[model samples]
Structures are given as C-alpha cells and as structure tokens.
Target chain A: MKARIKVTLKPGVLDPQGKAIQNALGALGFDGVNDVRQGKYIEVDVAGMSEEQARTEVERMCRDLLANTVIENYTYELAP
Target chain B: MKARIKVTLKPGVLDPQGKAIQNALGALGFDGVNDVRQGKYIEVDVAGMSEEQARTEVERMCRDLLANTVIENYTYELAP
Candidate 1:
C-alpha cells in the first residue's frame, strides 16, 4: 500500500517560507496573490500491510515524527 | 480562488530527505515501510480571478518559481 501525507502549519502559525514564496511571486510579476502557505507532501510505500494497518501506522508516524502537533496539522490518504 | 499545488521530485531522483525519514521510521519501530518520498504542497489564494485565469496564472507561477523544471514535476487543483 501507498500513503500520501500532507503536513501543514496550523492556522495563525507563522510561515516565513510561505511568505518568502509569496514575495518572490510578486517580484516575478504575478499579481493578486493574497496569500501562500507551504507544507510537506510525503509518499510512503508499505509492504505487507492492509489498508487499515497502513492507516494506523501512518497516523502514528505523523504524530511521532512527520508533524509538530502543537503547531501543525496533518492529513493522509492510502491507496493499494 | 484557491490553488493547491504539489511539487515532487521526478522519478529516479535521489531524495536524501526521504531516505532519512524512512530510516527514522524504521528506527522508531514502524516496520514494513518499503520506501518514502517527500515533496512540497503549496496553497495559494488568488483574488479577483476566474477559474481559467487562475489556472493559467498558477501554472506560470509553478514553472517560474515554485518548481525546478529540471528535476521536479508539479500538479495543481483550483477551487472557488
């Protein structure tokens, strides 16, 4: 199974990297961009695990390592 | 409009960050993990643009600033 995860900063958290990108876009002449937020997208391949097991495992991974729970949020999807 | 973009390394690219994550997961006792790849997820808010225009503008932003075309590929979705 494959799991795709997205970890993003929670609302009201400061995102300096996202702000840099937005400013760069403005310098590049792209207008009307009100905001930008950047996050991590992770794809994991698991062997010998059912969908339910993979979901549980991946969720733990997110909580333990992939995200800082105090400042970020994570979501994921699994596929065969 | 809102644009959600995923920028990922192309196939055959070496992802050291992903390898590190996989190793960390293994050390953390999460077994059966075959592989892991990491990417970027970006959300952009565009003001006063229709779907078609937003799509075009976002594509340009991806090509010009968000993605390194030599080794990265990007995909995006737009929502009102």
Candidate 2:
C-alpha cells in the first residue's frame, strides 16, 4: 500500500520560507501574490498491511515523527 | 483566492533525501517502510483573480519558479 502525507504549518505560525517565496515571486513580477505558506509532502510504501492498517500506521507515523504537532497539522490518504 | 501546489520528483530520479528518511524510519523502529519520496507543498494567496485566473497564474508560477520542470511535476488547486 502507498500512503501520502501532507504536513502544513498551522495558521498563525511564522513561515520564513513562505515569505521568501512570496518575495521571490514579487521580484519575478508575479505581483499579485500575497500570503504564502510552504509545507511538505511525503509518500511512503508499506508492506504486509491492509489499507486500513496502513492508514492507521501512517497516521501514527505522522503524529510520532513526520509532523511537529505543536506547530503543524497533517492529513493523509492511502492507496493500494 | 488561495492555491495549493504540490511538487514531486519525477519517477526514476534518485532521491537521497527519501533514502535518508527511510533509513531514519527504520532506525526509529517503524519497520515496514519501503520506498519513500519527499516533496514540497506550497499555499499561495492571490488577489484580483478569479478561480480560473488563479489556477492559470499559479500553474505558470509552478512552471517558471515553483517547480523544476526537467525533474519535477507540479499540480495545484485553487479555493476562494
């Protein structure tokens, strides 16, 4: 099974990278750009687990290691 | 409008970061992990554009600056 995880900064968290991107975009003449936030996407392949089990395990993985729960939020989907 | 962009490495590209993460996971005792790929997620806020316009502009952003077209693929969605 394959699991995809998206980890994003919680709203109100400072995102310097996002700010840098926004500025870079502005310098590139994409002037309409406003607030920007950057995050992470992770795809993991797992074996010996049903789809549900994979989802559960990956969720645990996110909570325990993949995401910094204090300032980030994560959501994931699983596929066969 | 707000847009979410996901950029991922093209298949067949060697991913040292992914390999490192996989090894780290194994060391952390999350044993079933197989192939792991890491990517970037970006959220952008734009003004003076309709949903369609936002999508078009963000797609261009991906092509020109957000993603390296030679080795990465990007997809995005826009929301009001």
Each candidate's DockQ score against the native complex?
A: 0.94, 0.85
Candidate 2, residues A1-80, lDDT tens digits: the string is 89988999999999999999999899888978879999999999999988787877898889888899999999998988
**DockQ agreement of candidate 1 with the native complex:** 0.94
Cα DockQ of the candidate 2 complex: 0.85
Provide the clash count, candidate 2: 0
Write one digit per residue (lDDT tens) for candidate 1, span A21-65: 999999999999999999999999999978888889999999999
Model 2 reaches an interface RMSD of 0.9
Fold similarity of candidate 1's chain A to the true chain A, as a TM-score: 0.98
User: Roughly what TM-score does model 2 have, to 2 decimal places?
Assistant: 0.95
Model 2 pairs whose backbones collide:
none
Which ten-residue region of model 1 chain B has the weakest summed lDDT?
Answer: B47-56
Docking class of 2: high
Looking at model 1, residue A35 earns an lDDT score of 97
User: Which residue ranges in model 2 land beyond 4 Å of their true spot?
Assistant: none
Model 2 preserves the real interface contacts to a fraction of 0.87
Interface RMSD of each candidate, angstroms, one decimal: 0.5, 0.9
